[model samples]
Target: METQDSHVNSDETKDPGAATYGNFINYYTFNPPENRLGLIPEALLENLGLDSGDEPVLMLDVGCNSGDLSVALYKHLLGKNASGSKLHLLGFDLDQDLILRAEASNPFPRNIQFIPLDITDDAESQICLSSYLEKHKRSRFHLCTCFAVTMWVHLNHGDTGFKSLLARLASLSDYLLLEAQPWKCYRSAARRLRKLGRSDFDHFKALEIRGDMAAHAGQHLEKHCSMELMQSFGNTSWDRSLLLFRRR
Candidate 1:
């Protein structure tokens, strides 16, 4: 199998365009341990029946900023099972700087790769992901993790936009780990928009994304995509819930 290195060593100058997204490096470096979004690789291994180890486990981490969480998951997986089982982690992020930083900081260069691509763009996402899969000779993703990303899409593109993204994700992985933000967060974002003299509820009004944003997303996934919620974990400090879903 052919492996492509997507890491680029650029001058550590911050791009002005990326300022609106906040400081990615500081966020990852200063992220609280309590808020760490850790994935249970053993649970995934047992659930997928890959415990005996037939082939390498292919995992995707969407919106993986700075790749800290991806590294943690990879380490946990290897720590739990040091047998013949192999883990291949692919992390995708829209920020080029974050991708660069992730690649630079990654200790296990061969086991993990970071790609800079906007998953919201269907054609671009498909092409980039498909090319990677083809290069690696993988059929489908065994597990996929999406954290702290859907709410942004929901705020910017509305409910339909978020659902479309979810559908695309479903096609890529059999098991999904999603973090759902509540309506309060959306309202808080609206408040920020109002402060900036921008219309706050336009997307919400258009998509009817009112009341319990988290529940709305969960319901949509269950009804439209036939995804069953296996388990849910909550972080009261962040006011978010991590939901585990399996295709039915």
Candidate 2:
């Protein structure tokens, strides 16, 4: 796969121009961990069948920022002693600053290994992933969670980037808990912002995973982002999930 090695600083401050509605996600428009906008760690563990003590399993938080989700995963797994499994959690991010902050915070289990990496940058992400896996080759992750991340890429790299990311992720985990912003929501936000003359960003386009990466994996894909699905998940639910192609 072709990879972009150019060290693109993803720091929101580095490029004010990039922070357009195209780059600025409503979810991350405010304090992140404090807001808990992405309750991904919990939902992912639930899907992974993590019950106390099942032998320390390998867990990866793809876009871990300040280790909030990493900490949540650790706390949740620790709460469960189902099989007495030890957890070897790995958190990766494109921002070195966040990785440093996560390391300094030390919020998760002592076993967690936080690394500076970016998924869009294939060489680094793959190397970091491979090295971490080899170091703890005993177990593979039972589940992986990627939430509110694809849209950011779609904004940056277009549909092709989103599809590539999904394919790459599918190759890495048995099951995935993906939480993406429905296109309607993005569109609504865009129109509102435009009407207010708040921003000069492109109109949000409708995108769905079912016909995209989900089809590629050939797994039963279900969308629960609609009103009914949202209700089931809850009004306070800040995220929605799609059980992506299952690894049979």
Candidate 3:
């Protein structure tokens, strides 16, 4: 693992245009957490069996940019825990500088943790995520929330990688609340890189999976991952769909 000094010192942390995998350094400045929070209803979370379990409730936040939404969601759920069940949330992203900011501003450091991890790294992710599960005496998280991350993974790794990500997320949690970026967003990201004079995403042009990515994700999770779509919480400001799935 790179030290804080080494991670934050990188040029990528200082410049958003340099980011390769859509992990923008200053992500929340343009898209505030409050806007995203407004779309999620409290009733949607209460129906997920989180508060019903006798054991501790665990939530995983993938691509938690600066941990703002993770902290907000944690506080939201904190109010729903009428059973007095202990709740813990683990948020991770590939950007280390963002993780540093998250850690610094964290008011509930004991229950909410932010780490720098690349979920695409199979061995490392398994070890790190599994270790967190082990410490809580659990095998999988109760719920996993991934907001607007699928496009970057798909554009970078191609069609196969996108399928693998869906399978992996399904295996890690009983419920997955996903917000997949639409096809237009992919085009936008690619165009941004080109405008910045950076090389295009390698797999973007070659990707076989195209159009209605959220629906595609839902199909893959249902057919290949033994998961079924439980609900669709509708689209966000960017027109991305928040689809919730449950392991069958």
What are the lDDT scores of the predictions, listed in order?
A: 0.68, 0.51, 0.79
lDDT of 2: 0.51
Model 1: lowest-lDDT 10 consecutive positions: 9-18
| Runs of candidate 3 exceeding 4 Å displacement | 1-18, 80-85
Model 1, C-alpha of 37: deviation from truth (Å):
4.5
Which is the leading candidate under TM-score?
Answer: 3
For model 1, residues 1-248, the per-residue Cα lDDT tens digits are 00022232121112211222222444444453236434243456666675565666788998887788788777766674443347788998887777888899997887788988777788998988988777768756888888767766776667778888788777788788887667776666566556545456547557676777667767877888878787776553576777888888
TM-score ranking, best first:
3, 1, 2
Candidate 2 lDDT over residue span 119-236, tens digit each: 8777877776777667766434556656556555654555566666776666566666565555544454455445545553332354444233323222322222110111122212
- What CA RMSD would you report for each candidate? 6.0, 7.3, 3.5
- Clashes within 3 Å, all models in order: 0, 14, 0
Ranking by lDDT: 3, 1, 2
lDDT of 3 by residue, 31-58 (tens): 6676667767765556775666567788
The candidate that wins on lDDT is 3
| Residue-level lDDT for 11 in candidate 1 | 16
